[model samples]
Target: MVFSWRKKKPRSFNGDKKKELEIPRHFLCPITLDLMKDPVTLSSGITYDRESIEKWLDDGNFTCPVSNQVLRSFDQIPNHSLRKMIQDWCVENRSYGVERIPTPRIPVSSAEVSEVLFSIMDSTRRLDQCACLDSLHKLKKWGLESERNKRCMVANAAAAGAIAAAFDAFAGESVDKNINVLEEILFVINWMFPLTEQAQLYIGSQASLHCIALFLKSEDLSLKQNAITVLAELLSCNQKYTQALTTIDGINKTLFHFINKPICPSITKPSLTLIYDIVSLSNENTTTEFINMGLIPLLLEIMIDSQKAICEKALALIDQLCETEQGRGFAYDDALAMPVLVKKILRVSELATEYSVSAIWKLSKGDEKALMEALQFGAFQKLLLLIQVGCNDKTKEKATELLKLLNPYRPGLECIDSLDFKNIKRSF
Candidate 1:
């Protein structure tokens, strides 16, 4: 399916036309129709660019492109011979505008990965911090280069454990000179997400936990973001990790700083994600920390001014916070809380509706002013619309329950049923 580039005649410097030759057909990838820089052969016995074919397989495609046969495996065998030929061809055709393909770094073997891990560990213990950081940086580069290397690195049990040990070493030091190196180590760990169960257990240990807690204060945005991302992953590992994170002092304040100060969008996203994960864990002290930190007002501000994703996450945190009496009281005390809650009911996504409705339900029960305020803010119509259209069962139930709470204060259902909603677009 590859097509050759067409030659075109253009005026030369002397005012005479010259023809440009087309790229060779076999030199191009069948999938991309571009020169195959890193050629690889799949089980289908066809050669294609490694990146193009890997993308195809990554998207869940399993059949051969030309033969239409199911591939035996997604494993790609490097077409070393074909790649050498392509390199030779590109070198010979340099005058024709062909760029020589750089040699692809070979994926590391399991033994090589273990060797690197042990080397890093030994260097760190010997206080050769410079060498340890250099080895980690190299491993990080390899992991970023290809999915093959990433898998190999993760399979080596010592990889994550060694990184955690190095963090402990640096954090325990009397000087701050190696803190930047720790930041680089954190960045590498973030790249290798979802560590193995054993690795997670090791990294989530008390010493490593304390080390990462210190990283939360790092002035480097990348380091701080990576630290939070790793914490979120650790929280997902099990209850022990969640409990461990909950005990870290000032964790909630550190996370909220990103939201309030407004760093780059990359930092904001993970900061919010970590907040959601902490709240979702439902740890009592963690919830109290979030509430006592004046997070409700800040969350309301973010929900009001942020994009769709941040808005949804802000609302979700508000929802979880409302589950506690302290959270409910804090939210109710906020000037913008009720208006923002009712406005988000039908305006944001389904999850937002569910969370907002649940928050309103918690606030409106037996609170005459809050219930009346909800109805005054067009919540009655919005609730009926939510039930009329469609949302999750929990959302519908909360909406229905809130409606019942407002029943005594309502005029009648006839007006609600007769109202026109043709122009209203329900987010759910």
Candidate 2:
């Protein structure tokens, strides 16, 4: 019960096995208390494991984890000296099962990022295909290095301008000629998420957006996934971009591809989210576009087959869409809608259950046909179970109301989902 790995242990069976030795306190990360594999120093003058500190900052904490001092700058430098010392310690204790840490590559610096960005622009301006392609590849590698590099690169105000200018260089080039470079550029731009400031302006224009739309229609799923995700972030940054997205030639239909015939679930989530974002911005007419695109039936299909997380998202979208009269009519028309909604009442997750029940509640608000459908699809029984089992107060209210709405259609037999309904007796 009082075992400790820090204390030295007796030698193992093999004579070559050395006695386990305690790891020096200084060699351990202040945060993790483990030997630092990739030690990095924050501006607050405290060292931490790179992953740990980045996670701390990423979680919205601006203060140093150990010092608890506010960090003015999120920038951190690799504690090369500390890392080397830890590596040596690992080697010195290798016989005790301590493995040597791999040497981390140097973090890309601001100056290097600037120079590479300049190289990309210069190569594009000079029509140096080889040079531009090479620089694009290099920049993507830096983007791939770490999240810190992405923050650094995106922080550069010219990053968006650089990407747009490079894209303009391919104005007349055939798609196949520089497809790789095009993909790389998208990859780099995507890394600069949570687009703060006016960075979105560079590609938010009609021309730039049209180009992105082309990529969205690309037969390549990887390229299309990147384009939709990038568009999703942009829409999140400013709903103004929605106009340019909708105006593009059949671009709205391109988004439909991911949700309609999703080649990858990765693409479907954003597809649903983007639709939600767009509908949230505009009115029910925009929901009409989605309905006309045959989104309702497909949504029901995704909810039935997708995993819980994806199903939750699909359910939320459905609930949002049903807020519109036309959207509600479409859902009511779909045979799967009531059945799927009834099945998801207490199934899936809390959010999914809420969305499913709410959608039904809204659809059946003043319609006798819809209420009959709910009962025909076993919505009465599901709502009964939802009450017998415990749920949040808000959900309980909705379930109770639905049960009341369906009480006239309740079965003649006694309840079977539970032995009693004492918990919800007041509602009855």
Candidate 3:
């Protein structure tokens, strides 16, 4: 069926006389030389159909024949009108020709582009106003539309120039003035999770823990480092933001998942610091969950493998854990395994002896059998060695106190000692 559709002609450049332009071969794909085809996406996510075009794209050859500049995704084609025009031209040409072909469209002009830009800016401004007024209903509606708009904007080039202006405005002082709006902006950038997807997307997956994990997985080290700093800040005021961490599945999963990843020395140190903070906030339920999930083993592994600073942080967490009744229960429950744990602690290169001594002290408060077992394992020798080796002054004081508790006294000696030693001195 033949269909008649009105086609918009390309705007002409200023000149007295019209000239017929010759199409460049470089602009044509060698295999298809008739523009490009199916537009298949490559493994690397770049889109191209022709082998030569794909090679050029892969080899960092990114320029529009029309624009003569580096062609980013949006720069290649910038608006729906242009995109539709290209598709229509392809269809029309195929109807009249024996060869199946691809058609390319011309880029749009600046002034027509400005009108679209103003409309988007106006819409964004309205949404921002709604967000400022806490109109979640309107915000949600506009937010979804904005995302749809993003897909188009990402595919368009001329539209992008206009959109860049909107972004500049979005990032300007006016948006900064609204703290809530700014927070909303951040949430959007983080890809705000719906309640259902929140668990699987953020909590269950490793990337869900922090945006940094995503960046890290993608090998964006700078973004990953920035994320760690942000995580530190998030955890620093954990008392205020505890709900955000625990209530969100992704946040909770991400925090725990880090325990299992190969520790980066840079991240490990800060991670241990965060662990200490989490331990400090531990309740019976949280501590039990931590213990049940093998937190102890992971922590012990870290202590044995990590640097002194990390080991110290681990020990501090253990100290805090043992201070709680539930934590004491965990210690006692794992007391049968105490000898093995102590072995690992002793094997640690840095601060092993110090942590071993502390572990012994903590175990002493566990079951009687555990205490007796600890003593039998030469815990006293380890403790004394730590003290003699210039262990922290506090550690020395604790060792002295524990030694007093472990020492045995004879009944007869106690009586003789209680007697008036000064008065009996002459007789002696």
Candidate 4:
């Protein structure tokens, strides 16, 4: 069995047509060790697949993966020649089931973004506005091409500010004249999240808020959804802007309209989320406005209709509403509210359970009917089950207290033994 090393023969394919093909080392991304579909050169003179390098940088990496050198800058110049070579190689290896990578479109430059923005604001004429909107649409389409392009769009302060200003400009225009432009503006803002505070201020300004409020009135479901989302973002950015939103004529009523007859699931979700954000602020006047607009009954219907995150949000909002005497009175009196609230515990998410229990606890205080209703609805079973299964400490405490409150009413309730009662007594 002895063999000489120098006498070994090279292996043959032996007519095996599906033999593995070799890929050029240069065509592989250094980071991923895979073929580079879109080779891009970094400022450190290292090459990587565009996605690989962008992800590395986006995850807070500042050094080259191979050299460990600090990246001087983040500009990623496309290696077109290498990309074309990879494409040709893929075409040459079509028998191996290799697919050619499509050419990537060039990202829009800051100058181009500025030009379109200038065109948009430099004129008030409808025809000119329409043309500018077309240009802006093309730019947006480019930005949608890749995260690289989105970063380019965000880096340009002028472009971001111009977009916010465009909203203000269109806000003042007659809806018949500028609704299309307004829609595009909302689209752009939605794409550009984490907007600069300055831009947020501009969007939250009186005029911009007015435009969004007006958008809610439109028959366009998509527009109304976008408006609600943008409005929600604006509220989160600055609490001061909430007063302006509440002051808008028919804003609360418009929100309820979407809640009642949702055009689509997408529209309904965000509308409910926006309501959650608004009511969570706990502004007396705003809350009163919501109550006056019949928010309680609408919320109950929405709860019956939705589950998952939307239901969680509905429950959270209800928790806030129940803090007020008026809201509590409305909810407690509703035949559907108590049972629905009780059923949510141990049923939805832990957060939903907490919200439901809190609302029930609020209603139960100094209200014999509320306490009686909860026990009659098997609240004791759900509360005991919540404690036996793990929940957050605050939630467990609330459940414990509610159990204690209801214990005198049900002496034979099985879950609360001597140890449980002792633990609850000691926690105080």
The C-alpha RMSD of each candidate to the native structure, in angstroms, is 5.4, 5.9, 20.8, 7.5
Q: Which runs in model 1 stand beyond 4 Å of their true positions?
A: 1-22, 42-45, 56-64, 68-101, 124-128, 155-158, 169-181, 276-289, 412-428
What's the lDDT for residue 338 in model 4?
86
Per-model TM values vs. the true structure: 0.80, 0.74, 0.41, 0.81
Report the alpha-carbon TM-score of model 4 versus the true structure. 0.81
Model 4 agreement with the true structure over 7-61: per-residue lDDT tens digits: 4332221223566677787888877667787899987888998888888888897
Q: List the residue pairs that clash in candidate 2.
A: none
Q: What's each prediction's clash count?
A: 0, 0, 6, 0
Better of 1 and 3 by lDDT: 1
In terms of TM-score, how similar is model 3 to the real structure?
A: 0.41
Q: What's the residue-level lDDT of 325 in candidate 4? A: 93
The residue-by-residue lDDT of candidate 1 on 1-428, one tens digit each, is 43222232221121122656555677677776777888888788888888787777767878876566799887778988988998997787676666789999776778888888888888888878789877888788888888878877877766777777676677666326776677778887875667767658666776667777787777776677787778877776665676667677777787788788878777777777778777877567778877777888988988876788888878888888888888988987888998889888875688788888988999998898888778767788888879998999878888898989887777642233233345677555
Candidate 1 all-Cα RMSD: 5.4
Pick out the ten consecutive residues of candidate 3 with the lowest summed lDDT.
419-428
Full-model lDDT for every candidate: 0.77, 0.76, 0.45, 0.77
Candidate 1 clashing pairs? Answer: none
